[model samples]
Target chain A: MPRSIPDQSKFAPGLTLQLDADQLHAFFPLLQKGVAVPATVGCTLKCLLCDQFSIPADYVTDRITTIFMDNRPVDDLEHTIIQDGSRVTLSAAMPGLVGATMRRGGFYAALRQGISHVSGGAAAADQHGTVRIKLFNLLLAELGPLVLARGLILEPAELADLLKSIPDRPLDSSPGTSRVLLTVRFNE
Target chain B: MDKIARIDMGAAGGPKVTVGDLGEYAGLGGRAMTSLVVAAEVHPLAHPLGAENKLVISPGMLSGTTGSMTGRLSVGCKSPLTGTIKESNAGGQAAQVLARLGYAAVILEGKPEGDDLYKIVINKDGIQVIVDNSLKLMDNYPLVAKLRQEYGDKAAYMSIGSAGERKLLAASIACTDPELRPTRHCGRGGVGAVMGAKRVKAIILDDAGMKMRPPKDPDAYRDANRKFVEGLRKHPVTGEGLPAYGTNVLTNVLNEAGGYPTNNFKSGQFADSAKLSGETQAALEISRGGSATHGCHRGCVIQCSGIYNDKDGNYVTKQPEYETVWSHGGHCGISNLDTVAKLDYIDDNIGVDTIEMGVTIGVAMDAGLAEFGDDAAAIRLMEEVAKGTPLGRVLGSGAAITGKVFGVERVPVVKDQALPAYDPRAIQGIGVTYATTTQGADHTAGYAIATNILKVGGDVDPLKTEGQIELSRNLQIATAAIDSTGMCLFIAFAIMDQPETFQALLDMLGSFHGITMTGDDVVALGKKVLSAERDFNARAGFTKHHDRLPRFFYNEPIAPHNQTFLMKDEELDEVFNW
Candidate 1:
């Protein structure tokens, strides 16, 4: 059954739904498709992943074996800075020669040197903005819940079909609200 | 595994079989055994489907032993598709069964008289060659089911479908998986045509009452095997990712990296790639009562193969691999997983190489025979091949021939063989391998994709020419060696990452063979295999000119990456330098 979570954060005009584990798990495909998350632009990937998303640093280092920022493989999380409207993809270690090539700081990094993320010096200054984040494979289970609970921004059209399937209306209709803030909590 | 069985189909009254010692071919197995035999015996200039060309089937060195992931069967011949020496391997019970039957290689030679089909059964009793014209034109799935009634499920059956019977250039020889399904195949280079030319429809290998090949140092072999399995199980790629999703797991990552060949290599990424991604495929499979993780062979620990079922929980085919998915799903502009699965089953049943058939269809689509993204047209085209219509004959000949017949300007082939899924323009390391490998544009010949895209061994920039030659060359050498040992190529990921895992592999080989196998010895074996293959190809009129990607790859810039194949011809020539 669908459960609703009380909104405690200052962020207003958002939808907060508490779903069972299975319901939340169904959203993995959406994660792979990518959802927008508000973040401080021009910060290191490590900062966005750990400090902003509140993902454990150890989990980011150990579990997420492949990271892609703007379609380029990210080898160094500490130096590669996030940009506004950038697309970030996270995945567990993949299979095949292609999978190994996408690993962070992997031995075969040179194979994808042309597509590897190159840091543009240091971030000039941090600014409030949003970046798209995508989770794939095992990472969907490991990091998906955390990101969902933290809330993500999505187009109203994108979630319309998904929300229609739910028993309860996830958010009250507000005119001119182009984006919806979706926070998913799992009811054990 | 000490004896070599030779079957001459043109024997005086009937086909005859003779067993002999390995002789000069001692200490060889898998691709090494097949390549060396083809190199030494077969006349290089002979027609691939003629009596002069031989079909050598050999198991890997460690096959039939209590080793993990050692069930690969290598079939080598002069490929009718490319007119080059070829060795294609598949994972199935055939390798383990055939090896346990006291044969290192089963050599089928000489063409039979007209209009007769034969079935050869080998077991502890002896080898029997019987006329079986009744089995003519039967596709693989039904043919195996029929054969099982007589031969029983205890044996492994290797057979070709209608495509092979017609001697189509894209034919493949099917090897039965552990479930007695002919899903695994040595699916390249027209090896099946060679078998069909010999008028042999099926080869039943029954190893009942046979014992495992004994290792010289059993205790050490066991210990090393334990460590090797541990390494594979501990590594995230082998243990978790592969077992969870199979090789189609590559679709999303490759698509995201902008190296995935879509719509006949015109684009690098497919918009509907998520629909065919491993994550989505696996979920759908489970929902339909199919398996997401399955082993093609008994000893496979990685289980990168799976079962695909229809919406109503009926079996369709084994999980379509990454290349199969891309070639049929994205390259042909069809994204539905069910369509891909249906096509995969049809390809397996018809006994054609999926890569070749799909690429041929793509080329045909480019010719205006069918519109892109037309799933019905794709199915109809494949059905035409099965029916052997006039157009089907042209399409079944593979991509290069289809391109020539239809006047499609941008055919993706090398040495007249269709390129696998990865677009060479985006992944340049694979481009070098495609242009230079003895097996035409085969990705597995030297999987630069591992390093270039997957980062399994070491990193090389996929989009640049730098380090690509060395990367391809090194991978080719290493792959040739591993293919000889009968281990699945997936082991390369774990071994390349963990030094102890590599040493464990060496130890397994050394202890089993009663010798000190080192890294240097492995390289030497690989070189020996490559040198023999290259020598055969050269004798068969293949020149450096034959070692090149289709001109379109150099001229056409694919999207997302906006890059063409960057390696110079001179740089490609350096791949075999070592």
Candidate 2:
């Protein structure tokens, strides 16, 4: 009974990115700081300007297929970075859910939820909140018994930490302080 | 040939089912009478997993209908999970066959000896107690095959997986459809484990060529059913939404609404959520070249079934749904659609509760036992559970066991079962349903169907439990009466929203019984069922104290929306008042 919502009620969570493909400079600073900019241009803005606005995970940038904000899935958003200077826009729709009818949002929405979770001290540092902290646990669910068939849970825990320790950052924000935006192209 | 009979195994003649007053309790639509049986026989407080238990499965009021989903049945008993009077409905041909042969609900009285297995098979003959050693250590998949080979697919089957065989409180009772796919289950609550405790491995029912003239008004019945189907087809929620997105359609919607429970009950969100959502599952289907929906039973107008495929479009499984996807995907922390889909395929075919298993695995992972998003491990563990290995036994034990093993105090389970998709902390109305329903923490029990059978006052705010008691009570009642009719609970969805549909149902029932009844009777029937269950629960040892949610929900705050399960205990207790 996950989505057992009552009738005529609308209380959902998501972030809709409304930006102009022509206004890259306008968004660069705010995007770099990873802050939300208010104002909507339109739902489907097919602008004729030969410009590009990159929907980064956090930091501002262009020319990336995915923007990984936390562990939210970003590859599912409709994108085509091939249209030209003509611009290829990709808004990263993210993930965060538990009950039924679970869906995906954008990078900003997932980031907002995670930061909010961490700030509220709901994840307990160790718990990682049910969102990000959960991927580690669910993956363990997929792997624990088999690992136990061979050894213990702590054995894999150490391995996960060791693997996470390998840095892939480009020295921007403090790695622990804020997650770096990844501008990854699926096939470029 | 041996006479088809039974061997009483508990207490004197094994805790006797009070068969007084009424005889021939057989074929009495498993859902309806199952409630009454639990009400009469089981002492509510007598620990759900303890000896003083009675598990009953009855067919619907009208089963065996090439009857669009009329072949459904119900399993009722005191829930070891919620410690409340409980009943779970499922789709299969067994109830139809068993009923066609004239047995209403098969009351499984007392407990069994050891883990030795037995089965109850009914055919042109009668009820036969067979030694079920052939499929003793097998999961539902292989077990179904073996049973079909022996009894033929013409016989409907109901069985449990290693999860149930292990007596996990989260275990579900699996049933086979016309397709022989054991995708349908009387899930939610540890009813299967109860059967497992009864030492029954499977229940094979074969009416073969038996004829059953269900009480129906020829033209009127047809008209009512037609209208019901039409209404289902017309509503956006039932028709387009469910069929298009299937139940997973709500994934993105639920996540957006902040009601989704990401990991256990710690948060109401997921990061890699889209990767495993209904939309994602649908995407996987399109990419992998598979179906997006199918029917749980034949002739289902709302065919929300899907063909989960491997990367190469090879047939993996069917009926990959919102619960399974969420539990394996978000709940277990895996954002991989294909991986979770594979696990769902394996679980469904094997006949396990994916949500329970996923939640259990998630809890285990939370205990630092494993990492989330491990596809190979999930597949391997699911396989082990199917194989009935010792590790599988532990895996099958579910979330409560994982919490116990890890010493995690934030276990969000009521009774002994894992909570479904909604975090009670987020949806306080559901918390009341979890806290008060006879079935422990089951959402389906009181998932109010618009305004169908019973009416409740006020619009219950999702986050608040203001009118939840009256709402839940009315739902519980209407739900019970509906189950007796052998209709899909989704039919309740129609009843809740459309008055005509509800009126049609009553009209059809009246036509069959040749009586004119008003809405007041619906209320009365619902009250009767609730009172019956309450009386049994009270006798069984359930004080007002048992009618409660777990403690951590109140103490902890779930983030994103930052709310806790804040319903007062007095409010919860008020739900049980007749």
- For candidate 2, write residues B1-578 as lDDT tens digits: 10112234464633332323234343235455778777766776676666688787777766654345466788888887656678888875666666576555567776766656787776776566666676675678878888888888687889986667777666788888668867788877778888877777888878777776455466776777777778877754456546655777545544544567776656777765655556556656866888776677665777766777788889777746777777887777777877876787667655567777888878777776677767777777777777767767667777777688778787767766677777665556567777877666666766445432354443343222344555566556666566677777666545655788777777666655556756666556556666777777677677888777789888888765577777788877777665
How big is the positional error of residue B29 in model 2, measured in Å on the Cα after superposition? 3.5
For model 1, the superposed segments whose C-alpha errors exceed 4 Å read A1-12, A164-177, B448-465
Best by lDDT: 1
Error of 1 at B228 (Å): 1.1
- lDDT per residue for candidate 1 within A1-188, as digits (tens), equals 11223232434457777777777657867887888877777778888888777777888888898998888889889898888899999998887666776789875565565667886668647776778988888888878898888778767776675576555444553323466777778878
What's the CA RMSD of model 2 in angstroms? 13.2
The reply for model 2, stretches above 4 Å from the true place, is A1-188, B1-28, B43-52, B82-84, B110-116, B349-351, B380-391, B457-465
TM-score of each: 0.95, 0.72
**Model 1 TM-score (2 dp):** 0.95
Give the Cα lDDT of each candidate.
0.86, 0.58
Query: TM-score per model for chain B alone?
Result: 0.97, 0.89
